[model samples]
Target: MRYSILTLATQALQKQQRWPQIIAPEKLKPHYDIIIVGAGGHGLATAYYLSHNHDINDVLVIDSSWIGGGNTARNTTIVRSDYLLPASFALKNFALQLWDSLSQALNFNLMYSPRGYLDLAHSDGELEHFMLRANAMCLGGASASILTNSQIAEKIPALNLDQQSRFPIRGALFQAEGGVVRHDAVAWGFARKSSEKGVHIQQNCAVNKLLTSNGRISGVSTHRGKISANSVLVAAAGGSERLMANAGVPLPMEPINVQAFVTEPIKPVLDHVVNYNAGLSYLSQSDKGELVMGGATDGYLSTARRGSFARLEDTMMRAAQIFPFISNLRLMRHWSGTADIPMDGNAIVGRTEIENLFVNCGWGYAGFKATPAVGWKLAELIADGKLPEMLKPFALSRFTDGALIDDAGIGPYPWLH
Candidate 1:
């Protein structure tokens, strides 16, 4: 039997089927200074920042399964800040800064490769949009270099240089800070270090409900028991909606399944992290020398994270277009993970209706790149009673406050998924 290797998630109905453990009522903690209800990258990262930055160590990082096993481990693992918004740039900047220093911070070799990221353009308007975004990046103090087709060819000679195709590579806006990380290592490192610092890293603990008191956040009821808290931060990506509904504040979220596959270990043919500039497709290479490739969800809604036959067909067509040698690669493994899509293709990182309740979700497919920043500001929000400058704009009230943070300007479809 061909066994699937996707694991590392504790609570991501986004991809794997993780069963929440059944707690027997007595094993719960009666109270904690803070309780973060998600053990994914965002949740665990939040816990790390809370303990390390905010000195809130009497905390717990509980997952339905295990830390970083969710979206954190299942990504194509490209980190970039080529977004078209100010807020995104700021958050990404912080995350990039953290990634640059993550090896030391987590005390583990994360295998972070600054191999560069490229957004290929196919037409004049597409090229124009790239420049506009590049200009936006310049204003944000981020180095976004615009490379011509010739420079692109020189930087990546493996691409099919033919000028005619459905989506041809015209030019690219390369971000030097952008790269790939070993997703599982980053997660395990954070979990390892944070546990050493005395934060209870509980696996197999799934939160079943959010206990409320007098119209404020109180605690979480888990399968292992209950942990009361002065504040709660919900960073569950795929499980965000279901958990929020327990608190009576349902943020608009659609669980979309994104599929990714790694080819049988091939000699490195693709160099940089290849980005689908026209849309949401992106490809990269693993340290083991596998040609890892993936793209957007099929613009449909489902909690299921199974790979569809259609996605394999769609991505293979695009891959062959970029590098004809990709045709010789064999499919080694295939799996799909969950992504949360809000009405707008952006993240929600602020207050919910419940006073002590907060959110760091709806990241769509782009949250992994902003992990460190999200963890920092979310820890601040959980520590201080106010929103920080970086996370202030992405508040949940945006939808009702007549404000929206639609970065890429992709409408409700979340094509960036």
Candidate 2:
């Protein structure tokens, strides 16, 4: 049933009992044209585009747990394209553009809010650095500008703008079009649309290993059984390392735990997505008035979906210092997800050593924002057997050839990313 005002009226009159399930269960076939190993946003979006745009309907998406039950649903859904590098900005800005029309395109409400995004600068050096970043972002097709202390104060009145405070706010880089979206809604929308187009989605069915032959791709051996595929795309964020290893290819990435939390519901306090550069913390107010917040990674390697208390405490402390009102709020919930951070603090999206074994992992904590573009480009890559120009710089080959797209310029430290 297509969702609309008329459908809503009919459903209400019918007592809403005729609503169909989002995705129906289907038995897996022994063979498929393409198989995606993760049912997260990126994987599902790729399947959707493969069937919708490329007319390749014989696709299957298998996940260990449930659809979007991984980082897709675990993130604090901040989306932005104000990156300092050209490649990163191009891919991300494409996704940001797609985000604007995603709800209508998928016939689902993704709840995308383009309030704005701010990166606070506490020192003069940081302000100068932000100026350089803003110029790069503007040149790369993202709307960015540097705002002075008074301008930032006008934007965020709750911020601790006093110069006497620790890490005083000096200025900021503002991207007026960047904001947040409903993370799980993206997963569900893509899943429902893909299932409608005859793509298969299997949950609780893990791919134990990648089955390869003669340096080419064959398929995957899953918990249920061995399934055959002409091509396989492993977009399984944190778990990609193990799956790639199964294909005899080593990924230069580390999966580390990242945590986020929300405060109890209150009146609307924050409008724009705010980031404290000195503290390395970020936050935004949800539609429900809950202050959604997150900070740095655990600074170590781990696949566990749990974070250390010390890191959480440090983040909250930084958040409280920036916005004193946070001190009065009680915690609503806290959770963590593992991100396969690359050595250069950037994503690795391209073909592996195996001919037909493609990958779209190592996005770290930025996967949610890049979902639409990654899915679209990955679908094209699989369909045309070529890498998109925007994705070339992020290829696995860059790590070896010293062409690392280190957006953070933090060296080859995945932990710090």
Candidate 3:
């Protein structure tokens, strides 16, 4: 049933007790045309695109946990297209465009807000670097501007800009089109739409092994049973490395733990998503009035979905320096999620060495922003068997061809990226 005012009225008349299920569970079939591993936002979006755009509904998306229960739920939910590289800028700009219409297209309230994004610069060198990135973003069809210290102060008056303080604010790289969205809503929206279009979503079904026949993928062996498929695409994010390794494909990605915390609900004080470039901390105010904040990775490789308290303390200290008003805010909750960081700092997407196998992983800290674009491009690649222009630079073969897309110029370090 379409979600509209009439349906809502009817439901209201019925005492709001007999609503239809958002997505119905289905029994495992003998075979499928395509089997995608991982049921996060990216996987669900990929399935939706495949069924809706390509008219291919014989697809199945499996996950070990429930939908939106992974990194998709742990993220700070900031979305932006501002990047220093042309390739990344194009891909992310496309994603931002998709986010604009995603709510209406999926017939769901994603709560997307284009409140803007500000990347604070604490030093003159950082300001110059941001200027270069801003120019690149503008050239790639994303709105970006360099904000002076005075303008920054005017825009975000609550921010502490005292010159005597440590790491005083200098300026910021402002992207007027960047903002935040309800992260879980994105996943649920796609899952509902895909399921309604005849795509199967199976949770708690962990894939144990890749089933191959004579050099090509035949299917996957899950904890439930062996499911056969003509093609397999792994969009497992942090779990991508292990899944691919099981299929005898070694990926140059590491699973690292990244942490985030949220403060108690308070009056709205922040208007835009803020990032401290020098301190490596980013934060935004949620619709519920909670201050969501996060910082850099723990600088180690682990599949554990938790971080050390030391890292949390460091993040809080830096966050306090930027937003002094939150110095004494009571922390409500904190959590961590694993992200797959590639050596070159860019995502690894497209067909792999295995003939019938493909991968869409290694997004690191940028996955949430790139979900839509990645889904559209990966669906196009799988449906038509050709890499889209926007995704060609992210192909896994780039590592061997000596073509690395390190936007930060931090060479060959997964954690640093």
Candidate 4:
């Protein structure tokens, strides 16, 4: 199976169409060089880099449930690095470069097709933001372009080019490197490869509390037993605060459930991934030609993935507005995933007040796009015990220091999930 997230995340287990890999129980040791909590893409990728790049093989990964059972596998696969701001641009560009080499680096088929992604500019502000991002990405060696209405009309002929049709179909910013990949393949590719390299991926192992002594993190108390380690990386997505709270490291994050759904497989259409900035929604035609649409943050304090039918209704109505042709497509399946929504739109990735406990959460909806850079940088921090200059700015203390990355870069709001 190919790992399909825009970034190649070596997975821990794969649930495929047939012959799925089993997630079995495993006992945790009392000690390890490092222990990474939450066996999602970020944790697994960190473990992979720690073993491969830093040669630290005594690393263990613990997940609350089966791997990829979090937001890691639930995102609508869209990849781009054309960010308006500098920091988001830097991280995304770095991730794009790593994505370019992911297939070869993982020695597997990522099915990474850079078939170009388009961001529709409905209003003047949206247009301005796209133009600024186009320039930023261009300077960063990305093949990004600002396309006029005529050009958009030429590419997507089915779209309503008439004025006053909600969006009016204004100019669009096109990033040729922006594309979609198979999300599931990425998780499995990373997990299988990393597990083979001797990294222990323990699924269904929920870390209940952290064990610390004299202001230093030493181990973790889980559902099964306790495990000791020198360094502990809490890569948990929605469960970030629950685990880190025990260590006195609080993240300004609340796990909000984001829902998405797909239509039944139809004939191949909507070749390119389309995102309407004005409507704040995105949809991509999957390999099976199913229109996979996802938008809007949902559920403020709910942990259960109970997606509201109203969300499905609202999103479907919005989809019909964006692509009038999709109104006829029948709904197939709907699901929701938890998002570690930070107060600021940016992610936290660095050491916290707790001595050896690290964090890599608050991805919102765009973390899948930055997995490669995150894994590489997080590995460096874990192995060397120091945060790099770029990642240092996104520390957990940003909320208190007021140095938060309040970048509305790709998100809908400046301070929302």
The count of backbone overlaps in candidate 3 is 0
Candidate 2, residues 1-417, lDDT tens digits: the string is 688999999999999999898887767999999999999999999998898889998999999999979999988899998787888889999999999999999999999999999999999999998999899987777789999988988888888888998799889999998999999999999999999989999999999999988888889998788999999999998889898986888899988899999999999779999998875789999999999999999999887788899889988999998899899999989999888899998998978878888998998998899999999999999999988898899899988899999888895989977
Q: What are the per-residue Cα lDDT tens digits for candidate 3 across 129-198? A: 8898888887787789999989988888888888788798888999887999899999999999999989
TM-score of every candidate: 0.90, 0.98, 0.98, 0.90
Better of 1 and 2 by lDDT: 2
lDDT of each: 0.80, 0.90, 0.90, 0.79
lDDT score for candidate 2 against the true structure: 0.90
- Output the worst ten-in-a-row residue range by lDDT, candidate 2: 18-27
Cα RMSD (angstroms) for every candidate in the order listed? 7.4, 1.1, 1.1, 4.9
The runs of at least 3 residues in candidate 3 whose Cα sits more than 4 Å from the true structure, single-residue gaps closed, are none
lDDT of 4 by residue, 224-331 (tens): 878999899998887888878767887787767788888999877677878876546788888888888888777355668787776677777767776888888788
Residue 255 lDDT (model 4): 68
Error of 4 at 36 (Å): 0.4
